[model samples]
Target: MTYAITQTCCADATCVAVCPVNCIHPTPEERDFGSTEMLHIDPKTCIDCGACADACPVDAIFPVESLSAAQREYGPLNAAYYEGREAGSVTSGPNFHAWGEPVFERVLPSGFAPVRVAVVGTGPAGMYAVEDLLLHTGAEVTLIDRLPVAGGLIRYGVAPDHPSTKKVQDVFARFHAHPRVRMHLGLDVGKDVTHRELAAHHDAVVYAVGAGADRRLSVPGEDLPGSLSARTF
Candidate 1:
């Protein structure tokens, strides 16, 4: 049996770093890491170490034996990522930076004091909010994302070919890389860290989460498989 990284599992690589046998694939450092929706555990190599479960901040990791019926599909989904792997499959390079590294550079106005702020989502809104906050105050920013990686919909929801729009992720990378900012990746505020915890840690909490679902088209066959909303598409 093996532990499966679930829908809530962020592709942050915390589990990958902790795994003794290196069973997890598409670690944040890998090229495909940024593109992957979530981290996938290699069941064949898992050894049932439980390191992944321990490392996961959102508690998204679960042993196969203990997986609820709803989560059972994740077991195959994780393995499917490496289905075609030959003896020597090429691996992608790391796409994300370490906690303290500079992902980008920013200019600030003179005489600013660090403000303590917590911004959620790490998407365009979150990135822009943090950027504005940084310029306005000397803020100790904590950027939180449910996924292991920071970029939100830009990483998961966006189409890969949309490079122009995807550039926004770079902006977020730099914001996260900022010295004043502390990126709390994989931390789901309500779960890994609570609202109260955030209130105690920061002077204010700014929620940048986007709208969850779009207004339905309200037409026939809208529920069919071919139908997709702007957000879903």
Candidate 2:
């Protein structure tokens, strides 16, 4: 009844943070996380609690019993990640502690003061930054985005066919209305609020604004008017 991570895995590591048994592999803390194509579940250590599946943003995790024919291979692929490693080792994953145990102190010192932060994007990068600041520190976040809505890349960059990937917006949206959060949408930074103004108010400012550029087709008419990139179209 163990769960497995399939090809659709986005490697956002959301599941890794919630797995009660820490069965997910190549966690963000691991060096291989950057190069790993996708995350896997260690079937041997999985308690079949279905926590990873529930936490998966892209719906990449599924129960072994429910895997389709094409996805069934993932069951073995997941188990192979832990084949040469022991569960309790550092490289093997975060299984050294007991299930649901706190591996590290996530709370800040009681004497720490709450600092205001201005994040200049409402996309995944901006929201993820906000999430960490709010959860791990006593920082007050001021969420700012040029668009009327939050969710930068998650809202615009992801294709319509990949609805599962969009589910992550729900995760990021949770912090938009937090007690310590102040949202400012439909406001351009340079035009409406200057960098100095943000710096003057907040102790820190994070610019998670992602870059978007059109790919060159190298065609003669590619640069002509009325032509737009797929991202823009």
User: At residue 213, what lDDT does model 2 achieve?
Assistant: 62
C-alpha local distance difference test of each model = 0.74, 0.85
Error of 1 at 58 (Å): 34
The best candidate in terms of TM-score: 2
Q: What does the lDDT read for residue 230 in candidate 1?
A: 69
| Tens-place lDDT digits, model 2, residues 6-78 | 9888899989888766678798878999697789888877778887888787789999989999888988988
Pick the lDDT winner.
2
Query: Model 1 segments beyond 4 Å from truth?
Result: 1-113
